[model samples]
Target: MIVLDFVGVGLFAATGALSASRKQLDIIGFVFLAAVAGVGGGTIRDLILGVGIFWVLEPVYIVVCGGTAAVIYFTAHLLESRYRWLLWLDAVALAAYCVFGAYKGLLVTGSPVVAVVVGTLTGTLGGILRDALANEPSILLRREIYVTAALLGALAFVLSDAIGLPQPFSACAGFVVAIVIRGSALALGLPLPTYRSRPGREHGAIR
Candidate 1:
């Protein structure tokens, strides 16, 4: 679990740095964005669970974020498409975080519902914060299977554990489910159906 957390944080930090690169931000900005994107979701999850923030408890996570920023700062320009890198990295982080976040929530709260919610939040919030900070389109606003993928990942983990699956297996299953869904969305341009009002009833009177 610790390894999973570190992997997710590092990838999220990379996405943050990539966003900063797109904006041509300075090193300080890169670090700032990386820190937020790396720890934002976990921080919220810890607070909601009434536990110490993971990165605050172990400052190495912050160092990881900083190191990722520095590396991307030097290498981001080499990428032919930073946006593509950001999307794929964020997808991987989302998958890892969703499973781990659900695991944490189930450990701390013993509620599958809360686990699912926390998992989704943990998976998506970091990228949301990063995009907002970078003045990019919010992932939540997209029609793609972003939040749904996270939610399903969390559900998969919780369900697998409930059925007596080993923790490691459960986590892996969840990650696979999430990544497959998100990757399909990215590669196939798959989108969720959107609301469409009737032609003349777009502004129907409210009750």
Candidate 2:
């Protein structure tokens, strides 16, 4: 499970750098983004529980963030297409973190609400931090259903637990909810609603 976390850590750092790169941010921006993206969720969790941060004892956290930033800095041109694959990759990482968070929360705190909230933070804080750094509109802040999707996925996983499903199967079901939500968003261009636009200011109104 730590291995999976590392993979997600690396991927999310990579994703953050990709977002930074797309915004044409500098190297400092990349490192900052990576650092924030790497530790954002853990930081939030620790803070909420009134515990000291987790990464302080784990140098691997710094190494991963720094290494991911370096890779992005030197290989920016090679990954110009990152934006194209960002959504799917983000979904994959999101699913991994959600399962891991829920598992840990349930094991440690044994509270379903804690499990769900931690799972959400674990799944989303990195992207939220990334958006904050980029000054790009957050996927969460927009009129989209980003956090809603994650919460529903977590709910599904919790339901699976109540039904006595295998942990792995439950995790997969939760992951599927996230993937389906994200994929459908991608395929159908789903987004939040907005007020009416003037005739000349029309922007493909959905409602």
Candidate 3:
């Protein structure tokens, strides 16, 4: 699980650097963005779960993000397709972290619902923070199939674990589900339905 968390940190750090690049930020900005996007979700999760901060306890994760930012800063010109790369990389991190979060949630509490919520938060919170800091349109605001993917993936992990599946296998299953769903959304423009307020209801009176 620790290894998986580090992998997620690196992947998310790259996405954060990509986000900073899109805004024409400087080297410091890149590092800041990478650091936040890499561990923001996990930090929040730890806080909510009343545990020690993961990266604070293991400073190597911060080093990984810093190194990733430096690399991205130096190689910026080579990434003509940075946005696409960021999207895919973020998706991978999201899925991986979702499984990890679910696992941790199960450890902290026996409630499957809470575990699923934690999974969703673990998958999307970092991206949310990145988008907010960058002043970009967030995935949560769009009807794109983002959180739904996380939810299903988390649910899958929790259910699989509950049914006595091997831990690693269960995590893999959840990760695959999230990545496939998110990838399909990216490739096919698949989206969840958006609510449309009725004309009469807009004024708080039913027709």
Candidate 4:
């Protein structure tokens, strides 16, 4: 589980590095953004849950994030299409983090609802920080089904756990659901509907 968490951190760090590159940042900036993106979500989750921060408890995770950033800093240019790869990598990280967060939440709270919320936060908070630091619009605020995908994945994990599935199986179910939903959105351009004001009807409901 620790290794899996680190893998998610690495993936997120890569995306962060790429985002920094897009903004023409130096290596220091790249590493800083990468570390932030890698651990922001998990740090937030741990704080909210009143659990000790994972990376602080286990410094290896921080090393993984830093090492990942350094690697991406050096090799980012070699990647033919950074944005496309970053999207897919971010999806994978989201799925992994969602499952990890829910699993931890279950151990702590034993409530499916809490687990799902924590999982969703685990999946998205890092990306939100990444975007903010990069001066990019947050994916969470976009009309696309980003948060919905995380929610579905977390829900699946909780449901599976509630049904007596093994830990590994439940986690896998969550990860797969998240990846499929996110990948579908990326490939098919799926988006949630937005509210539109009707020319005359908008004024009738409030007063």
Tens-place lDDT per residue, model 2, 11-58, is: 778788788788888888887887887778767776776666768867
Q: Distance from true position, residue 63, model 2, in Å?
A: 1.3
The digit string of per-residue lDDT tens for model 1 on 59-100 reads: 999999999999999999899999999999999999999999
Per-prediction TM-score to the true structure, in the order listed: 0.94, 0.81, 0.92, 0.91
Count of backbone clashes for each model?
Answer: 0, 0, 0, 0
| Cα misplacement distance, residue 80 of candidate 4 (Å) | 2.7
Residue 97 local lDDT, model 1: 98
For each candidate, the alpha-carbon lDDT, in order, equals 0.93, 0.75, 0.88, 0.87
Q: Give the range of the ten consecutive residues with the poorest summed lDDT in model 3.
A: 198-207
lDDT of 3 by residue, 153-194 (tens): 898999999999998889889988999998898788888766
Which parts of model 1 have CA positions greater than 4 angstroms off? Answer: 198-207
lDDT of 1: 0.93
The positional error of residue 43 in candidate 4, measured at the CA in angstroms, is 0.2
User: Candidate 2, overall lDDT?
Assistant: 0.75
Candidate 1: count the clashes: 0
Which pairs clash inside model 4?
A: none
lDDT of 4 at 57: 90
Winning candidate number (lDDT): 1
Q: What is the lDDT of residue 1 in candidate 3?
A: 74
